[model samples]
Target: MNRADETGLAARQGAASILTAVLKERRAFDDAFIAEAASGHLRNAEPRDRAFARAITATALRRLGTIDHILSLLIDKELPKRAGATENILRAGLAEILFLRVAAHAAVGMNVEAASRDENARHFKALVNAVLRRATREGDAILDNLDTERLDTPDWLWQSWSAAYGEETARAIVRMHYADPPLDISVKRAEERMTIAEALGATVLPSGTLRLEDAGRIEDLPGFDDGAWWVQDAAAALPAKLLGDVTGREVLDLCAAPGGKTAELAAAGAHVTALDRSRPRLDRLEQNLSRLGLEAKTVVADATAYAPGRTWDLILLDAPCSSTGTARRHPDVPHLKSPADRDKLAALQARLLAHAATLLAPGGTLVYCTCSLEPEEGVRQVEAFLAAHPAFRRQPVGVEDVAGLGEIVTGEGDLRTLPCHLAALGGLDGFYAARLTRAS
Candidate 1:
């Protein structure tokens, strides 16, 4: 095969391998992609081809439910038991035909060619060709009256969202996933944010997050190396701001790795102590800080167990959870996580929140936040914390605090943003943050 054909085939195979890792091995998508690279499955591929592989993998995962539904209609019977990547190959090909704008012939011919080369699926190459070719001609008719929103979302998520936000709102959230979310960034130079946005051809989100639509390869963006801005979802950027006027305050950031929140706190003139358990993640955070020209005291210690010598004036805890709110950006979330996963993470969050409350300085502010849609991780978690610890009371956030996105601030005044909240601007991640303080 020529180099171009070989590159395209390698991309397709790499995508299928990643899909297999996620679906069959039950690995996280990012981890699987990393494994593919580290293991040399994609390390030798050209940059453009590697990107294509990632795109195909992400698209297949995101539209998995819909793709599976279509496959059930076209394939009358399953293939041989030993068919290794054949099913995923069909999935990747079909996703390209239906969602991506690849030419029908390329999708079909390339996928068929891939099947021909795989020892396990070579016998069923005809099946792959027939199914994908038929899908090209009849896929639209089958999708015409289908409830794609429901099909695309897993039952556990749909039911949980229905119970938490009600059925109508759950459907709306599902619909929001269909639109490609825009990249929202936080500019360190507040006075120059507008100028940066203008230079990058970005729209200033209501929350002051510069929204960049179709900005390819974030590292390639101008000023990225200069650390002028960082890619943070508009909703994800709200929590650090809740510790009002953090200038010169002693700030502790728990779970601060990959430190978007830590960067925010530092940029706002806080004397920051960033703590997390993972050394590698902390190294990355430190690297990010270096690039941004920000400074923070870093510690590799568990948030739940660490008891520092003294308390801080302000603390920001962006605890880890099921991460369902990031489904739009990481489509594997709905497939990889479950209610049990939420419960497990909720327990950890409780431990972290409880420990954090103890470490707050008297009359100090504590801001607890999570990028999770589940109530147990957000509303309920804070409610339970406040109930158990009467000393700390909620310091209700306001619309003005977040640049007038009132619809996101809850009735009780916590910042509760949904992926469907800012529909006109392609929506933001679902996030819940509560600002609290202990009385003097």
Candidate 2:
């Protein structure tokens, strides 16, 4: 076989392995990819092969519901419990043919060979070849007619979003998840936004964030090692911006692992303290800070119990939640999360928010935010906090504060960004933020 053919085969094998990890093992996609790469499963593959494997795996997970529906039509009986690997092989194969536009012949052939190599799944090799061939012929028609919005999203999540945002918005959110999300970056210096955007061939959003079409590895980009910018989602950067003019002010960033907001505060000249419960994630945060040449006092402690022994002029509690908003980037979220997970996270968020309030000095601004679409974690959480802590009151976020994202602002002046909002700008993560002021 030619070199290109060998690479394609290796990539399909890697894709099936990743699919198995995500679906059967319930591992996160990033973790699965790292494990596979570490094991040398993809070591010899070209960069294009690696990219293809990643794309196929992500597409299969994102559209898993619909892919399963199509498989059910082809297979008469329910798949056996031991057929998990076989099922994932079919999913990876079909994802390529149906979505990635991979050539049907090559897609089917490689997957069949991959199945044959696995002892437990070898019995289904013929089935894999037959189903994928049929899928290449008729899968498009079935996919075109299916209720994709319902098919693409988990039933529990879809129901919750519909109840919270109404049917129309929920459907929009599901539809957006089908497309690959764009890359957004935050420049270290606001004054150089235009120059940086031009250099990177990126578009500068009204909110002063830069958007780039997902090209390749971020480390390969210019100025990456120069500490000129860092990667932060457009919606995520808003919480720090709400703490207007942090020049020389003391700011505490709770649950700040992976430190995007802490970096924002430091870049704005705030005396920043970054706190989180996970040491591994904090290590990553420190690495990013070092790369950007910014500094923050990093503390490894639970935000709920962390007391710095001093009141802060501002506090950003970007509390941990279900993280459903990041589904666009992390497709494993829907499969890994459930309604019960949301409840547990919401309870944790409340405790963190309350403790953060204790560290806020009189008249200090506190921005409570979550990358969650759930009201119980965002709007209701803030409402409950305000009712319980009469000493704190909502400060009302204005359109001017979020750079004309007024449509996302609620009647109570909280910012609620949905995955469907800014469709023309390639959408943003579903985020909820409420700014409050402590009574002097």
Candidate 3:
């Protein structure tokens, strides 16, 4: 095959690999898979090719529901129950032509040729061609005009969000998921912000984060080896900052893994104990601490069951939930997760909070947080916890306490962030963090 044909083939093959990984292998959608696939076609594939593959996969994932809806419109009776491979090719191609604005002729021809190579895909070429061509002209209106309710999210999820945050905010959340996420970084030290931003070709966020327009290999960046900073969304870095005046105080970082907040705790001169369940994940936390030259006591124990011997002055509960708020970064979550998943996760979060409450010293602070947009997992979860345990009271995060975080913190003392919050600055991650105190 010639150069043009080679690139086309690489794109198709990469998409197929990613589809298999998400659907079959159940791997996280990331750059590693694309890079691995590129090893075969182009010797030392350029970042451009890697980007093309990632875009195709991300586009297909974000718009899967809409693309499937459009496909149903084209078929006379129904598209055959063909192999997953064939369906993935059609989905990838249709997504590019319909949603991503790739040329109609190019998308259709390349996909058809790519499909013909596989025995199961050969028969679907005609159907695929028809769908892509039809989508090329009217696809935008078809997608744009569809009921946002039926776009990608489950009805129950939409209803839950509407009930909690109103219909407008909920719909805005859905819309933001389809928007691309910018790469965000948190500096280890304050003064390094300008140097790091200039070095990585990033701009300094109002929140003091380094926001990169285009995220490339981190190892090649200025601060990667020196450990001047680590990659973290601006919103994700807020909870630790809100835990005010931790210097010379004992803090418990519950559910700390990959230890970003734990680093913050140590950096603030807090005597920190980082607890997590996974040994491998804890190993990573140790590695990160070593890189930052920060020391913290590490424990590998379950959050719901583990108990520290004594009470802590501060506790950071980065509770696990459905992680729906991170959909822009982890697009597979919405599809892989169900309403049942949220309910189960909420139950577990409540359990963890119940346990963490016992470990807090009188008048100490506990910051309950989750990288989840779902109210059931955040506000509702905290509300339920407060109701169950009267000793714990809301210690409101005052505007003066947290710099650059006034908008996200609610009057009720909850930190609520959505993907739409900083759209112009390449939007922050959706998350919720609440600071509470145990009465003396």
Candidate 4:
């Protein structure tokens, strides 16, 4: 094989490995797969190859339910037990043939080549070729009859969103996830948003987030190393803004690792103390801060256990949850999380919320947010918190607070942004945030 073909082959092989990791080994597609690219599956590949590998892997995971369904239709009978990478190889190839729009010949040829060479799957090389080729020819007809959104999304998530947001809206959310999420940048200097966006050919959203379409290789963009802006979802950026004008006020950022919110707090001139349990993630936050020329005191401790020995003027507890809201960007969410996991996270969030409440000064504001579409983690979580802690009451988010995105403002006046909320502006993450105030 020539150099280009070799890279292509590696990318396909790498995609299969990623699928195997997510599907069989049950590792997070981002944390275990892409984050470890240099030392993991794509280690030997070039940057372009790694990107291609990621695209293929993400496509497969996003459409695995339908891909598996189509594969079942194509196969006459099940293959031998312990089929090695056969399923992944088939999945990666079919994703290319169907969703990714890769040329049929290349997608089929490379994956067939992979199967023919692997000792475990060599016996099924012909089967792989037959299945993918037929998919290229007959896939459309089959897909025309398939409810892809229903097929692609997990049952528990579907039912949960349906119960929370209504069945029609839940379907809309799943349909939106079919498209890749747009990149959103949060600028340090709020007034400079338009100038910075124009320089980068990006548009300013109603929420003041800079939305960029087709932004390739984020670091390669202007103002990256200089840290003029950091990548944050438009919806994810809202909660920080809810804690407005932090100028010189003391603020506690609970569960603030990989700190976009910390950066916002620091940039807005809060005497910020960012806390999280994961030292490595906090190290990343520190590096990002160093790049942005932002400053914040860092604490490595669990939000549920940490004791600051003093109260703060404001607190932002972006508690940990299923992160289902980010499904458009992180396709592994539906495959990885479950109701049990949501329950587990909800329990943790409750504890963290309770602990954070104790650390807030009387008459202080605490903004609790989660990138979860699940109600148990959002409205319900805060509702229970307020009921138990009579000292704190719902301050209620305002239409103006979310930069005039009134469609996302809930009836109770919290922020409940769906992934499909701003579809005309390339959709945002499904985020929920409630502002609560403690009485003096």
Comparing candidate 2 with candidate 4, which one achieves the higher lDDT?
A: 4
Residue pairs clashing in model 4 are none
Give one digit per residue, the lDDT tens place, for model 3 in 1-440: 68767677667757766765786666777644644564643235556766676788788888777777777776666646664467778788877887678888888888877777767777877766776777787778787788744567766767877887788887777777886788888777778779778888898877787898667677777777887887788888888877898889889999999898998888778999999999999999999888878899999999888855788878999998888889888888777778888999999999999999999899988999999888889988999999999998898877775565577878697888887787777777888989999999
Better of 3 and 4 by lDDT: 4
Summing lDDT over every window of 10 consecutive residues in candidate 2, give the lowest-scoring window: 34-43
lDDT of model 4 at position 199: 87
Give per-residue CA lDDT, model 2, range 1-440, as digits (tens).
68777788778888888888887788999999877766745778888888888899999988899999999999988778776479888999989989888888899988898788777778889999999999998998998899978988998898889999999999999888888999899999989888889989998888988999974799988778898998888999888889999999888899998999988999999989899899999999999999999999999998998866888878999998889999999999999998899999999989999999999999899999999998888999999999999999999999999998888899999999999989999999989999999999
Error of 1 at 80 (Å): 4.1
lDDT against the true structure, each candidate: 0.90, 0.89, 0.80, 0.90
Candidate 2: segments with Cα more than 4 A from true spot: none
Q: What does candidate 1's lDDT look like per residue over 1-440, in tens digits?
A: 89889888888888888998999899988889888876745877887888888888888887888999999999987756799889999999988899886899989988888888888878888999999999999998898968888898999898889998898899889888765689989999899898899889999987788999989889999889989999899988999999989888889999998999998889989999999999999999999999999999999999999977888879999999999998888878899898899999999999999999989988999999999999999999999999999999999998878988888889888998888898888898999999999989
Higher-scoring candidate on TM-score, 2 or 3:
2
- C-alpha RMSD of each candidate structure in angstroms: 1.5, 1.2, 2.5, 1.4
Q: Give the candidates in order of lDDT, highest first.
A: 4, 1, 2, 3
Q: Tell me the spans in candidate 1 whose CA falls farther than 4 Å from its real position.
A: 37-41
Better of 1 and 4 by TM-score: 4
